[model samples]
Target chain A: MELFTYENIIGIAAGICTSIAMLPQLIKVIKTKETADLSVTMIGVLIVGVSLWVYYGFLQNEVPIILSNSFSVVVNLTLLICWFLFRKKS
Target chain B: MELFTYENIIGIAAGICTSIAMLPQLIKVIKTKETADLSVTMIGVLIVGVSLWVYYGFLQNEVPIILSNSFSVVVNLTLLICWFLFRKKS
Candidate 1:
């Protein structure tokens, strides 16, 4: 059996935590169909941040990191879009 | 001048992106003082994921990773707490 190296454990934990963090927002957005309370500035800032992460992942050649964060970018962008559309309608 | 190696760049980018991703929700919770739209399950999942990342960092002995994710844990936990408080009040 392969030993679970400390590095692998940490990486996995980071991935899990970050990924789960998105859940509450995702659920809230989906169920409430309301993002009035959400801030546009915050979402914009987040987009910039995730974009940097993607760039960082590319530079590092870390496939797992890149892939996970890329997916995150997509999810965040979608939420932002949803917020915008909802706001415009209301 | 320190050379921006591919790994370093990627690490920086990931850090920026993941850190920024928290902005929208944080702002939303703070501004509106409402977490009605947020999901408890999602927050729970994220907490687990970040915890894993912290563990992974410890296992790997990567100070940067551990430090960054530890900060993330604090931010995320704060948001979760805010949500609970808001929900209870509402």
Candidate 2:
């Protein structure tokens, strides 16, 4: 079985994009100390959704899915933490 | 080929979760007319990333990937439009 193929590369690209999609928001929340406008439900749902992706990756033995979703989980978790800490103050 | 398998079901679940993750944010933006804390960069990147996923899906001929990404593209696009419409007013 080929580990790195054209199809997986495309998946990796998609993963990279979606994985880092929330970086700016997380940074903005941390730097500006503003989070009221951000939706808690959305972030929460993302955590659940990305976790499922991680599970799906595990089931499929897809490295990109696992790695990307793991990275996104971390990002989303950071955002959630920031939201909790700063939302009240903002 | 099994169209509905346990693995595919997991993927579909993941897809559904992620696909709808942005709904809350979009709704909040529309309802409150607030966009200050929401990062435009994040949304823009999501659009690009999800589009790649759509392409990846096409390459792989994965229905879940195609459908879920297509849904997310619509959702993210709507969010972007909402950001533009309400960001200024808020």
Candidate 3:
């Protein structure tokens, strides 16, 4: 059996950790229909930052970076949409 | 004035777009103290994905990727913390 390199493992591990970390907040937002505690500026900065990651991935032709960030962009966008709907209702 | 290459511009654009997208949701969450609408699985996945992006950036020796994702990890983690506090309250 060929062992995965340390770098690959680390990358995969980090991915898992970050992904898990996002779970609670996403869950809370969906269920409560409230995103008031979070800051707009921070989210905005993050969105731009992730977009840059996607571009960087494309430039480097890295599959993991592209796939990961693309998915993240979609998820974050969905959250934004939810926030809008919540606002419209309230 | 030196014009950035198309690739650089694209990278910057994506970063900005993604970062902007995160703003509303974060704001809503903070203001309302409601994150129930969000899914744990989804946020978890995102956190993991971003972590992997960071690792990928490091592996590639890319400055933009590393910096952007690092910041994202921090932000996402903060949201998670807020979610925990919110959950504990309700």
Candidate 4:
């Protein structure tokens, strides 16, 4: 069996991309105090989704999926809280 | 092995949740015509992330992942275009 096929590479890259995808939004939200345009439903659903992914990783015994999605859950949670705090501004 | 293990159930739920997570945001954006609070960097990164997911699915030959992320890519792309369109308002 080959180690690190193209599928593995792309899957890993995709996971990493999603894991860190929210940082920019969190930073922008904190810096700009803007949250009105961000959808609460989207954030809520994402939290649920990432949280499920984390559990699924455990069930699938996939460490990479677990770690990446755990990070995403944290970021998503933080973003959600920030949205609540900042949405009232402007 | 059972067909519907907890992992599969959770994984499928996660995929479904992530797939449709953006609809509410799109609806909100269209109804309110607000996009200033949205992050272009976040959107850009997400578009890339989901697109890569689609490719990863193809590489893995996972029909569910491909279908779900394809829907997400469409929604994310639409949201990006909407962000561009409505950002100037208010």
Native contacts conserved, per model: 0.86, 0.91, 0.66, 0.84
Model 2 lDDT tens row, B1-90:
576988778778889888787677677777888887667888888899899988877886667677888999998898888888887676
User: Weakest 10 consecutive residues, lDDT, candidate 2 chain A?
Assistant: A19-28
The CA lDDT at A33 in model 4 is: 88
By DockQ, rank the candidates, best first: 2, 4, 1, 3
Across residues B1-90, which tens digit of lDDT does each residue of candidate 4 receive? 353666667777898987677677778878888887577887888888888978876765555456777888888888888888877785
Better of 2 and 4 by DockQ: 2
- Residue range A12-61, candidate 2, lDDT tens digits: 88888887876776777788888886678878888998998888778777
**C-alpha RMSD over true interface residues, each candidate:** 3.3, 1.7, 5.2, 2.3
Model 2: TM-score for chain B: 0.87
TM-score of B chain for each model? 0.80, 0.87, 0.79, 0.80
Better of 1 and 2 by lDDT: 2
Query: Candidate 1's residue-wise lDDT over A1-90, tens digit each?
Result: 233455544554566566656666767777878887677777777777676766665554444455667777887888888887788655
TM-score of chain A of 2: 0.88
**How well is each residue in A5-90 modelled by candidate 4, as lDDT tens digits?**
77667767887876677677677778888887577888899899988888876775555467778888888888889888877685
lDDT for model 4 comes to 0.76
Candidate 3 residue lDDT tens string, A21-56: 555666777898887755555655666666676777
The pairs that clash in candidate 4 are none
Whole-model alpha-carbon lDDT for candidate 1: 0.67
User: Would you give the TM-score of chain B in model 4?
Assistant: 0.80
Query: What's the TM-score of every candidate structure?
Result: 0.68, 0.81, 0.55, 0.73
- For model 1, the superposed segments whose C-alpha errors exceed 4 Å read A1-17, A27-32, B1-17, B20-38, B79-90
